[model samples]
Target: MDISAEKLKQLRLERGLSQDLLAKQSGLSLRTIQRLEQAGGGSPESLLALSASLNVSPQALRHSSVPTISHWSFAQRSVQLSALLLLLALLLALVSLASHGQFSIYLDLVSLLFLLLFVPGVTLVAAGPMGLIMSIINLSLLWQHATGSLAERRFLQQLYQLQYRLCYGSALVLSLLGLVSVFYHSPHLSTASLQGALGVLCLGWLYAACAAELLLRPVLFKLNVSIQAEQHTLAN
Candidate 1:
């Protein structure tokens, strides 16, 4: 059966078992262990063996790790749907704006991709490769344990915290660079030069604001709500 590779890796890590050790403990081959963790395909017997070794139920290794839509309250579902629709609306609006037939200095496919990549790229450069890698690992761990552990909730909070910081930081960096360029070339700055520098400044802030408001914030809200609801249920 198809299982959750993330969940499997999480369980193994939580138990402090290396792949080689886990294979020996589970009586499965090392290659099988790697394959299961990478692509999540194994028989029922393999699942049972891994579960026994990991001290979790076989179902826990399956793909039903996260809370599903059916488990959410009506209000939660409505909020999620609204968030999704809002994203779609924002996307359509962007498409409409770009398709207005008038030439734009910045509204094109290349610029869109650059805007999307720039924040994370700059963040990685600023935070260092190792920091970004660890953050990603924490994010993956957060995905499965968000509602199950307080530590994971802390990570969830940190997730959005990092999101906004990167967004604003990138925007501010670009704006400052733009201003520096404008000042450096002040004596010879033509209309096109002024517009180009200002475009960098404006696009930086615009993309950052849109990403925070339309994408990251909504996702963080949903996860926070789900975590709170799960905690409330456990408390009661």
Candidate 2:
């Protein structure tokens, strides 16, 4: 296997362990550790042993040997863009049907403002500033991935997973809050109040599903494919 000598040495040093100590802990000979650290290749068993001793995954100890494409071809760009547009069109069609052909209901400023504010606001509050910032940075990395950028699979995976969890979590919170509001006013609940509560539930669910399906799922699938391909390449 192709191990990363620098990463191995760095991991060992970060844990404040000497080469001999790492070798002893991993149950490998000191010479084997020295050779692996001096060079970059090792058997999978050696890689696994080192990873276990270092408290890091085997993948973390390996290097990205595949060179990433700096730019995508025109056809690749067109296909990606077309898929995005088609998904948008489908979403619009579904929304129109759900609204009984009144697609303009979705264009109402109040609902739009509520959606624009609620999801991100809740995510920010829930994840805190640094977490939100990292998620945003990872989101940008995901955009780069779409442009034939094959680096940072780890960050891209984190971006989608974080957003996916936070989005659904926020939606559920919104729905529960709305339900609480309705229940609190049940004694004097009017038609308008009922409608408002239902709207909140529906909008929260709709926004979460839209965000997940349109953005998170595709990036997650792409990341999975990239990781699998990387593993296959490394194995070969």
Candidate 3:
């Protein structure tokens, strides 16, 4: 009630509850509760849960007033972005293996389909609901490419809008050229070509990861909404 995370956490412990249990009772994710108790970004539902689980009144929570930040910082975002990068690297490695022996016409078609679908699918999973808007298209392009429905124009348009679009483009074009060279001229999976392409893709991925980490970070708190009433002293 004093706007101290330790106080709230203390109350939870006194009630013989773990953070996870407290979060469950309050209809919050464990992560959200952790953030709230850590004095970080979390859903407003945390306040509601505190009131319900602790049997405290809303007024008690509101009594301290909410803290406000004019800007979000990078202290916590780096952690999450590192996770994203790890996931991307894992997916790339898996895709390269899966699409290995499937480079013939029909194999290429199937492999492409798998790449297009699987990559995004895993990303969507790893990123969860939050990454939908920003990452959906990138995943989709890879999906379409795998299915052999790859459209160069769509990629061009999509690339134009991304923040690191040029970097991605540079990387993508080089990969494409490498892939074409390896596929048409050689038979087996092109290790050199794949590595080169992966290099470029990695660059693009880094660009995206950095951008995500630095931009639109979550910092939930309160806003100051003030009202002013004007008085009229006309012939009263």
Candidate 4:
């Protein structure tokens, strides 16, 4: 009876037991469970103990199937698009700063302040808890990306989708607010301040549009591929 590691891990999960709890239940050391789960080799005695603890026949844990990687069609497109947009934005910001001299510094500082205060609040209000969770997941995926270990295609697809949703949602809310501000402001305010507010609003909308079209739409388009795959599987 040779059980594969994947099968053993799946059985353990089906029993709703953590590795530590399964270890305790089977009278096996935690390290033993971990090793078995990772390497798929254990003595007959250990196998019997785990089987007994999981209430399964030892044969059920054997002969695990190989894991399949998802084929994410949008991953490369999303990465390339985001990189291009980021590069362009950086170049434009730098050029504008250089052209404006000291005044650009003041504008940049003010823009940063506005962004810091507005982006998070609007994202939170619009996306709520789901957005927060997705943002955390995105951050995790980004870390994986940075480390060159983001191998899960499904996860990458999800990260791109969530990022687009966040960007589009924030952009829509901010654009609406800007429109309202334009109409409701008191006549006493200086034209320069009004122009500044409009500039900030336009900047936010521009960023959102670029993100949605360049970085997000490609990911959205790839979603259909996943749907078709599922349908094909079902048809078979």
Top model number, lDDT: 2
Each candidate's lDDT (Cα)? 0.69, 0.70, 0.45, 0.62
What is the TM-score of candidate 3? 0.27
Task: Report the lDDT tens digits of candidate 4 across residue range 158-215.
Answer: 5556566666666667668777878688475689988777776666655665556654
| RMSD after CA superposition, every candidate | 13.3, 9.8, 19.5, 11.9
Write one digit per residue (lDDT tens) for candidate 2, span 1-236: 67888999999999999989998999999999898889877787888899899888998999876455334335345545755886889787878777796664444354445556665675677667766665565555335553344455665566568678766776777778778878898779888878866775777667777677666666676566666555654453
Kindly report which residue stretches of model 4 are placed more than 4 angstroms away from their true locations once superposed: 1-89, 92-96, 99-131, 139-169, 175-186, 189-196, 210-231
What is the per-residue lDDT of model 1 for residues 1-236, given as tens digits with 9 covering 90 to 100? Answer: 54678999999999899999999999999998898889876776888899899988988888864445455557555655776687797778777777885336445443345556776676577667765664455444222323446565555566566766777776777677668878898889889878776765677677777777765665566567666665553342
Clashing pairs in 1: none
Candidate 3, superposed: residue stretches over 4 Å from native: 1-3, 40-42, 62-236
TM-score of each: 0.52, 0.52, 0.27, 0.41
As for lDDT, the candidate ahead, 3 or 4, is 4
Instruction: Order the candidates by lDDT, highest first.
Output: 2, 1, 4, 3
Candidate 3: residue pairs that collide: 112-146, 112-147, 113-146, 113-147, 116-142, 116-143
Model 2: lDDT equals 0.70
Off by over 4 Å in 1: 1-75, 108-148, 230-236
| Root-mean-square deviation of candidate 4 | 11.9
With a 3 Å backbone cut-off (N, CA, C), the pairs that clash in candidate 2 are none
lDDT per residue for candidate 3 within 46-116, as digits (tens), equals: 56667788897745544254343223224334434554576687567657766886322122232343334
